[model samples]
Target chain A: MRPKTLFDKIWETHIVHEEAGKPTLLYIDLHLVHEVTSPQAFEGLREAKRKIRRTDKTFATMDHNVPTIDRNNIKDPISAQQIETLEKNCKEFGIELFDLASPYQGIVHVIGPEQGLTKPGSTIVCGDSHTSTHGAFGALAFGIGTSEVEHVMSTQCLWQNKPKTFEVQVNGKRPKGVTAKDIILSIIGEIGTAGATGYVIEYTGETIRNLSMEQRMTICNMSIEGGARAGMISPDEITLNYLRDKPRIKTLNNLDSLMDDWIKLASDEGALFDETLKLDATKIAPQVSWGTSPGMVTGINNKVPNPKNFEDPVKRKSIEDALAYMGLQADTSIEDIKIDTVFIGSCTNGRIEDLIAASKIIKGNKVSSKVKAIVVPGSQVVKYQAEKLGIDKIFKDAGFEWRESGCSMCLAMNPDKLSPGERAASTSNRNFEGRQGKGGRTHLVSPTMAAAAAINGRFTDVRSFDVDLGEY
Target chain B: MEKFQTVISRPAPLDSSNVDTDQIIPKQFLKRIERTGFGQFLFFDWRFNDDGSINEKFILNEKRFEDSEILLSQENFGCGSSREHAPWALRDYGFKVIISTSFADILFNNCFKNCILPIVITEEKLDYLFKSTLEFEDYQVKVDLENLILSDNKNFTEKLDIDPYRRKCLLEGLDDIALTLIHEDKITLYEKASIE
Candidate 1:
């Protein structure tokens, strides 16, 4: 038998049909939907008079436009209407929905993993790009458009070209302050934003194996930022451990047999990859983006890049434009950049471990008067866990607004947004121009980095902060 | 979806790389359920001032590019987010084709589904197109989907590549939903066998 990459094995298994020169019709095991993207998909189904073929496999949630603050009372008529439409559509289509009050309600990416719906070797599709987040569980997950979403809803299949596979191997022990967020941001910086275009990345080597499930999810969530179709870590004992206590896993009748199958989901030894890149994990610092794109990143100790240093005219112009939009000076120290707000949550870094890491820095400390900081947990379950450990109190005591779970200030679809021209140290992925809000400047950072920034009102090295991780 | 055979129209030059989905249609405008109205809100933050007046500094607001039907952008156009609204806005705003050095995977797929021909050209060609479109007033390029060619009618011409299945689907105005319906019986059979 030919040696196969993990992605190749999963891709071959899900294929329903294929011809010599046509895209394969791949079977989807899970279809996750959200309010913003699913409305049009449902409308397409309604227009066609088609029914959801497998409603049991589909899950719906109202996340993007839902208000993180004032959870029960949604004021904006447009947002309210979108949410209402989703609820109504899910009911009509007989698809299960995790509504605002539901315990499972959270960001579509966050809640899918929390409920154990994302499993090893499964194919997951959602309308949102962050659907790649589920690839952490060894699933061949990727984002699809609303039209494709409708196709999956009606046919339970997608016509997809098999993406080439790339391997990102990271070795050596990570430095204490450096995290999964830092590691991914570093990789993106090393390989420009479009480096992994037309490929799915299989993260391997010592560093990936050592990461906890939450940390792995954080890395996989940002794969899109690097232009990969998806990023996955092969399932192992660590993945099984994460799934064991999940609600969906507990209800399974054949857990022992399922575990055995999942353990075999790794790529075969000597499997071929189209391309390979190696990174020394110990060299990664607490990273931060100095420009609008995730690729325009530097370590916390580094200075903003001078566009003049770029040899390519196009690259130089992009850097100049990014600097102008971010209101950053070329060659200035990144630590000197002042921030008015600090956002400490998103699917990228909103899990309970992320909160615990942030709280470790924020405990017994106060946020700078000039900085407005907020902490949003990834899901209701994460929020409950944080609160149980008094992590929420730690943030509240440090003057950070501990809000309900949602994609708050991540893309700023909800009321939680930075005002125009406000500079923020954000833990979310993507620092695209005005992504957080119209004319809002976002500097992407890890949770610990964001916490340190909140305390200092500027980008600060988390390693230098007088905090003990053991206490948390 | 509309059937797309060929288009000959003036091209607008957006000389920026990594023009993400949020920038195409900011998250604020994504609340609308209907796809048709997004044209007005396309590049809302960039097109208009905070006071609701036109920002003439923006290239799309320029007089020469007013009625352009083709968009010539730099690498990685429509990079972030998987919003089909990005294409909806572009199509609504009267762009029949988008030519770029590269496109994010999902955006490239979404463009075909929405009948917007996304042409992946070489960097040299993209640079030539960007330069020509800026230098000449009312510069038009002809994109022939059936022939798989992009020509300026004068000197520059390039052969483009597209998946045969996608090309067939677009020429016939067929979407994935329509294509999938052809094998509804197979899908049903597979689903039933797995369940049992």
Candidate 2:
């Protein structure tokens, strides 16, 4: 029994009704679908003899399975079929689709914010779990399954029980070497993966407020790492400023009027939470996942976790397995781990601001000869804006492959895959074994970290390789 | 379109922990815009051979669990990724109850809406449940929607704790759309009032 937080307020506003033990039905404001998770939902509709109820609420894009460099080459038949089926499904269902050739095509999480489809105090769902990326806008968003996808498509509402509220306040400003990604990674490591289960996290405190939209996005994007349904930052002057002048966003409410309502998005001073955690960001350092799960994280400067330190046999065995799979010594420093691939994209860090940070790290520097690097803009609009600023040229000049945006190398559905046992430093969420490719090991890091890894051909700190930013 | 009750023989054993949505329904299959024919591709990579033949090594291919309609799994089953296809594939491939010691937050939430039951049982009970599967005969589990109970001829009976609201929706087969239509009268009145 907690006082109403922003999550409760937003969820209650959309509540149609509730059943006692059954789930309450919630009206979904936006439904984002990508090629990888939509086909089945569309197929379910066909089987049920129904069509998409609201075409406007639903949007489709191809990202997970589309290749980055081989735009013209159709090397993999399975990848081609998946993309083709998505096209067929979208066309037949009359849903808007952003195919590969279309400039609107990008990561679904990235595209929603750029298009203003993501609004303050809205519920968003996609087939991709990192849809938590939308929570940066102070929206309640999470990944849904195909059946729920069909449910959203047909009715624009979903069955859900309101989750308990949890507030994570990070006091003090972040240290220079620490990014939002590092802070979240440290938090996940502290809480473990299932710590925030059945909770909607409201992040606050001066540290969270000081973060840029890109940095807030990076923090909120990985809420799933600690198993949150969604993570939200209260819509403040920062949120209002970010939404100003967006196209369709202005159609609903202009920025001036919207700010008046948006400021009320914070949790009340006396609001209660099922749980509360206060983090001091000043002490956090750059972190990396030593094991398969993102929660198996540690300071970049620290040695690998020893099995002797673990109390749970399951977790210890998992660490042992992970260490064996990752081919690392228990006491070896994380900085010593070399990377074969460095990907800076996906919903987590694929934004204009992410590119700006990465470019500063790789402005005149070159990627290591042994490392294959890719920079994917989160959205088509982000791509265009970055191109206008010649961010694309800076990356290309630094020898990173400039590719059309998609969930490239985040999950190995696309041609951008790692060979078996290949190690990667990725900006996307998730670091499970074989996540990037079958038998491919991924190390989750921020985009700047990915750039640093690319330059050194090993896990390194971006701050160490920083070139001067022109100005504020 | 059909209304019938199915009495499942028993739950099958899947020892693998942290079974992800990617493993259940891969990203490759997600490209299809439609939802049908997913059953065939369910567990495609795990249960099928490279040549599209059945991989006898897979648990789903075992004859002992061939008729099983329920799955009993380890902690954090369905851990990674939020592909709805995982449940669609599970339901389409004829699974109803996914009894696990624990489940991922996102996956468990998706299960109820997809008409799949995600039951959380005690670890001690899970140990007993896994042993109970050793004897295939008379291990039958009866799930009666009318009674809202999960029981067997044996002394084992577990009452499901579905939210009463969800119970109504599930028992009545009312999805979100049906629930929304219940407020039609109020909506109409509000619309009329707005115009006036």
Candidate 3:
């Protein structure tokens, strides 16, 4: 037998049929849904009079439009109606829903791993670009359009041209205060926004193996930002440790046999990939995005890049436009750029460990008078765990508004948004123009960096801060 | 979905690279359940001012490009979130085809689902098209999907390539779900075998 990559192993196992002159028909093991993207898909099913093929495999949640501040009072009529529509669809189709009243309700991507639905060697699809987040467990997961979502709901299958495999090998130990968010952002900066257009990336090397599952998820969550539909890390003991205590895993039989299978899912030695790129993790610094695109980023101590540094006319134009939208001047120190808001929540960095890291920096300091900072956890489970650890109290004592969870201020579909012309230091994935709000400027940073910025009202380096995030 | 074979119309040139989906259709309009009526809000933030007035500096606001059925952009078009609403907005706004140097992976797949032909061209050819369209207000191009040819009246003709399966579905307006349901037996067998 030929040596096989992890992606090839998973892709080959999921194949149901491969007809000549057509795309392969692959079976999906999980289908995650949310309020914003599933409404139209259910409507498609209703119009066709088709029943959901596998209700047991589907999961639904309310996010994107739910209010993070006032959890019950949904003032926007359109958003309320959208939520009601999802409730109606889930009820009619007999699909499990994590409603607003349920303790499990949260961002679909966050809750999936929390409940152990995302597993090794399984194929996952959601009507969200961030579905790549589940690939952290070594799954072949990717995002889909509503049409494909409906197709999967009807037939439990998808037709796709197999994507080639790419390897991103990161070696060496990262410095203290640099985080998974910084590593992923630096990768995006090195490989522009369109770097891995037609390939699935498998992150490998000593650096990846040394990180926790939460850190691996943070890296996979933003894989879409680098233009890949999916990214994965080979399953190992870290993956097993994260899944052992999950509720779904606790219900399964023959745990040891399942573990053996998962361990075998790693790529074989001497397996070939279509392309390979290497990075030294030790060289990475705490990154901050300064422009509309994720690729327009620089280290914390550096200044905003000059558009003249780029010789391509089109590249220069993009940089100039991004600078104008961000209300920034060329060669200005990143730490000198003032911010009015600080947002520390998203599927990217909204887990309990992320909250703990941020709380460590904000324990004794107050948020700047000029900055309004909020910390919304990723899920109800994460929220409960943080409160149990007294992390929420630390944030509240430091003048931060500790709130509920639901992708708040990330895409700004809900009430938590930056006002027009407001500048925010955010922990979300994308920094595209108007992503936070119309005419709003967003600079993407990690949780610790966001907390430090909230304290100083500017882009401050977490490395220089006088706190120790011991053993995190 | 609509059947598309060929289109002869003016092309609206979005000269920017990495034109993300959030800008194509902002999140504010995504709350609506129905898919139609999105053309009115296409590029809402860029087309309209904060005070609800028209911004004449935007390219789509120009009178000559009012009825464009084709969109021409630089590399990495539709680079952000996987909202199929981006293609719906472009389709609703009378764009049947998009030409670019490259496209984001999810958005590229979503275009085929929405009956839009996404064509990839070389940098040199795209530069020619951008220059010609910017120079002439009434410039038009002919996109023949059946023969995989893109041509203008003057001095440019290039052969394009598309996946045969996607091209066939668009040319015939076939329903993807209905087509896949034909393999129900195989799917069921695979499910049963895996369970055992």
For each candidate, what's the DockQ?
Answer: 0.83, 0.43, 0.89
Label model 1 with its docking quality class. Answer: high
Candidate 2 per-residue lDDT over residues A1-472, each given as its tens digit: 5556888778877775565655677777789887666666677677678777678878888888777777657677877887888888888988888788887778887778777788888888887778887888888998877667777887777768778888999998676657888889988898777778788888889999888777888888889878888898878778877777566677773466666777887677788888999999888877878788888888778888888789976677778878887877898888898989888888888888888888888888999999989888876788898999999999999898888777778887777877878888988788876677766788888777788889999888655754653320
Best by DockQ: 3
Per-residue alpha-carbon lDDT of candidate 3 for residues A1-472, written as tens digits (9 for 90 to 100) = 8999999999999999998888999999999999888888999999999999999999999989989888899999999999999999999999999999999888888999999999999999999999999999999999998888999999999998999888999999888898999999999998999998998999999999999999999999998999997999999999999999999986899888998999899988888999899999999999999999999999999999999999999999999999999999999999999999999999999999999999999999999999999998999999999999999999999999988889879999999888878999999999999999998999999999999999999999999887887644
Q: What is the lDDT of candidate 1?
A: 0.91
TM-score of chain A of 1: 0.99
Q: Best to worst by DockQ, what's the order?
A: 3, 1, 2
Task: Give the alpha carbon lDDT tens digit for every residue of B36-62 in model 3.
Answer: 788888899999998999999999999
Predicted structure 3: lDDT: 0.92
Question: CA lDDT of each candidate?
Answer: 0.91, 0.78, 0.92
Residue pairs with backbone atoms closer than 3 Å in model 3 (clashes): none
Query: At residue A121, what lDDT does model 1 achieve?
Result: 94
> In what order do the candidates fall by TM-score, top score first?
3, 1, 2
As for candidate 2, its interface RMSD to one decimal place is 3.0
Higher-DockQ candidate of 1 and 2? 1
